[model samples]
Target: MKTNRYLPLVGGLLLSLGSQAQTKLATGSQKPMPAAEWIDADTGHKIVRLTALDGANESFYFHNNPFVKSLGAAGDKMVYYHSSPAGKQLYALNLKTHQSEALTRPFARVHGEIVGKKRREVFYQVGDTVYATHIDSKKTRRVFVFPADFKADITTLNADESQLGGAWGSDAEKEIYRQYPAKSDFFNRIYEAKLPRTLFMVSADGNGQLTKLFTDNAWLNHVQFSPTDPRCLMFCHEGPWEKVDRIWTLDTKTKAVKLVHKRTMDREIAGHEWFGADGKTIWFDHQKPRGQTFAVTGANLQTGQEKSYAHTRDEWSVHYTSSADQKTFAGDGGYPTSVAKSAEGHWIYLFTPEGDHFRSEKLANLKTHDYKLEPNVHFSPDGKWLIFRANFEGQAQVYAVEIAKAAI
Candidate 1:
């Protein structure tokens, strides 16, 4: 192995992290690890395991958007799923105080940690009922519930927070899901089924005026509204990426459907899309030929232009997220058995956009992590740490790898 010249400097910053966490709560599980930090042996990057204990602790999914930073005197706050003694419950962490407080009673099914940065609340669905729970006050408000006829789920909140976007599958698609409930079993089947999917919007306040925006015989998955433009809603033709032109945007005002990324050559594909902080560009995992060449590509929604920064095959990540400044990026790498079949890819990566390619640095080693639980990475609001969840420590726990080699 080639030695890093910074290893000496990296070694100086090491804080011994045992094979497992040491602190345990009175309830017989590891205590909430708010300040638990360590240097990864393989990469020499500091890794802080956010959650400790047995059950899976999770952060929000990659495309669910911001981890909600309310920069007040109390400091910035981020919400997550914690395996509390009460079972699965919502919890919020105060980064400044390094304190965590459980936010919700265990909900059977909470949709997404769709944090409202301005409102300081998280919007999630419990079954067909939607709720918004305040992070600071712990006050929960029952929002609108889905209508009986609408059999759809809320996907994204619009820029002005006026509307919530969703996709409704035709009965054919629902039946297909019933037959092959497992995604792997029906992923391709539902795509090939080409069942009609409808894109619609409802008042976020639940005033109940639902408007059907667009309908097509395509798998309209990954529905997201622009963070800066409420009028622009993006959705994908979810399927085997190579076989379909995945990225698309629809203007809710004009009902215009625009294909965001077009394949330049046979088998070129794009998916796992997300919007920039300003919502001007759409960034996604891009490959020129399926599992071959890899890059995180972006498209200018206003200019109809695209740019890509290439990376090695082994560096291909299941998901990539940009920093608050859009100056840096992070990736959650695939395991050896993944589609990339990467030999040395089990590490969380920090990527700097350099010319046509990326300058890659390994942040945390995940060689022992179970690939079944994807460590969806998100950059800190201040862009100092990359937060993700992993199961390498025997159970899934949220972790953050310091981007800087040494404490700044």
Candidate 2:
């Protein structure tokens, strides 16, 4: 292992603040509203909005992840990153009490993940190092550190919270963009160079032991773990939606790697892939002929069976996620790629995997913008709430809708 000489300089900085616990309650006039009377057209479940914050603070849910691992029901709290005048800080919102508390001191662009089903420990990265803090005790420990010149992208914690995985590299694509900056052909230029990127796993118990599971000369991104299967995890070769072979999975026990929904032809774009609630299947949004649209697609990791659950004749329903039971699927009609057309309107839809799939109903009318990131709708572990981010009140804010307070 290569030693970072600067680690000693920051050792004191980490030790000084490691044991300190800081917290503040959610303030201001904005408060979460009760369930709206609007009945979901398919399930007939009442929709309830769960958050209303006044300022620009927002949650960090990604488009490709189906579950908000950070927002699991420990203490009924949801963790999010807030950009204050001081810096970016992590905050936990207690759903029952409707209070937001500070979890860490303000730093540069801080985001977090919650681990363990019952214990609920949190993980987040600052610079090239990852840290863990228990939700109840607030005990902090340094989990892992990356080598010099390499940055961590898309940090993920495994199902049982035994390991943490991330994509690390020189971030050459971002640096190259500064040199050859172009609006349309920027990614095309970056792909011309085989940038060094690696998939790394480390002990989640703050052992600081790092293992490089896979390395590539391409842009590897979105490292995600299976929710049920302990040994299974997935990643992507990220670039223009159409250019790369999108999804790949790795088994930690066997060190086996396989492509989930492999593209056999050109213009077959498959990106924004995630695992289902069962952890047996991987789900993704795919578009053939590149610029057309996307449909809901999935591949069973155990059986290797692939199927399409939903597709569009007119426009694409780009991002796809599912309920915890895997019985329900949700999608937003907005595609974030430059090649795909601008979204027609801000709408999210829901569908059943088994019957009446065509009867996908509009769940919410989102306030969205062009050329900006779209809200990735995710379900809670219990499948009762749909969590998403939107710019409804001018700035992006995290919001959740209770789909079924009790099972219908």
Candidate 3:
């Protein structure tokens, strides 16, 4: 692994101080809210708005769990999926009015399979049928169907869904869809239907038959299609007997697979690592057994090379976002970090530790290359805003940061 220079900045500076104030309680007693929301700078609108509906309740009730999913900008509007005691729903938050209306059909919840592309079209599941809905025309059509016995469980579906490829083909032509088993226990045996352990492809129209791209029975923990080449994919392969895990590359057309990285028995790759925007590199966390220290490695897929950004025993996590052009990258490398890249690829929103509150930073240097932060930070679909839920300022409340200089 290649080592880079270490330029340390001062520990704390309150970079976002006074730009925004914490929301106070109804009694003016300053009871900090348990969750917060933010808007993306590039889209010039709030992509997320959430709050604590169930006060201090942590029992496993689905309604009490507050989380955001399927946040993106489609056409002239911002869209997202949310769940509550009422049920699962999809909404289009009008950028002009700041109003949200349920787009999900009544009695037919928006299954976790929903995904939005660059156009106004959204792919989602209702019952056993996968449907695509156009936000502009309010038209919906069936895109695919599962086997008769297959059931739709939104929660499990959320866990199993993978964005294997980009929206490449036109609506009339070929489109790539990635499917995974909703249940982890299903990994023990191959489905009689010839489905793969994790990575499988089918026609967007659901006409062509399902094809298993990778034969390895090992569970494919994560799979990503190369943004540059839609026919190429990168995925992580693991099994019970293996001492370590490695990432591999596969060409769908040639039906060829190659081991891009070999595993060392003493260390394991972290599951949540992601590919760089360039599609030629992958970023992952490497953990050392019996040691508290961890390091982040960026591996070049073509050259079989790696570079380490940071190594520490501080229990830190890294969040990364790269420009659309793949020329610039911005991320926060630390514990409990949050980062969002602008869609135009010019700026990044970074939040770091500051006692009870998170100090926010809008950075323009895409070549800084090495840093670390805490995990679970999210970016808006337009890549202009960063949003997260945290217990800062005595309680969790939503906050937004503007990346004014990020338009590429």
- Candidate 1 vs candidate 3: the TM-score winner is 1
- Cα lDDT, model 3, residue 16: 23
Candidate 2 lowest-lDDT run of ten: 7-16
Over 1-408, each residue of candidate 1 has an lDDT whose tens digit, in order, gives 111121111211223334432322111022343335655656666676655454667888897863565455564666888764556777776555545676776577465667776677788788888788888787888777777877788888899988888898977788888999897999999988888899998787767778899999999999999999989999999998888989999999999999999888998889899998889999999987888888999899889888899999889998898887777888999977776789889889999999999999998888777778888998776677788988766677777777877432
TM-score list, all predictions: 0.88, 0.78, 0.57
Q: Is candidate 2 or candidate 3 better by lDDT?
A: 2
What global local distance difference test value does model 2 have? Answer: 0.61
Per-residue lDDT tens digits for candidate 3, residues 2-27, read 11111111111012212222322221
TM-score of 2: 0.78
Put down candidate 2 lDDT per residue, 321-373, tens digits, no spaces: 77767778876557444345554434566667654234466555553332164
Off by over 4 Å in 2: 1-54, 63-75, 106-109, 112-119, 149-154, 171-174, 177-186, 313-315, 335-343, 354-358, 367-371, 402-408
- Candidate 3 C-alpha RMSD relative to the actual structure: 13.4
Q: Note the Cα lDDT for every prediction shown.
A: 0.77, 0.61, 0.40
Candidate 3 residue 103 Cα shift, in angstroms, is 3.2
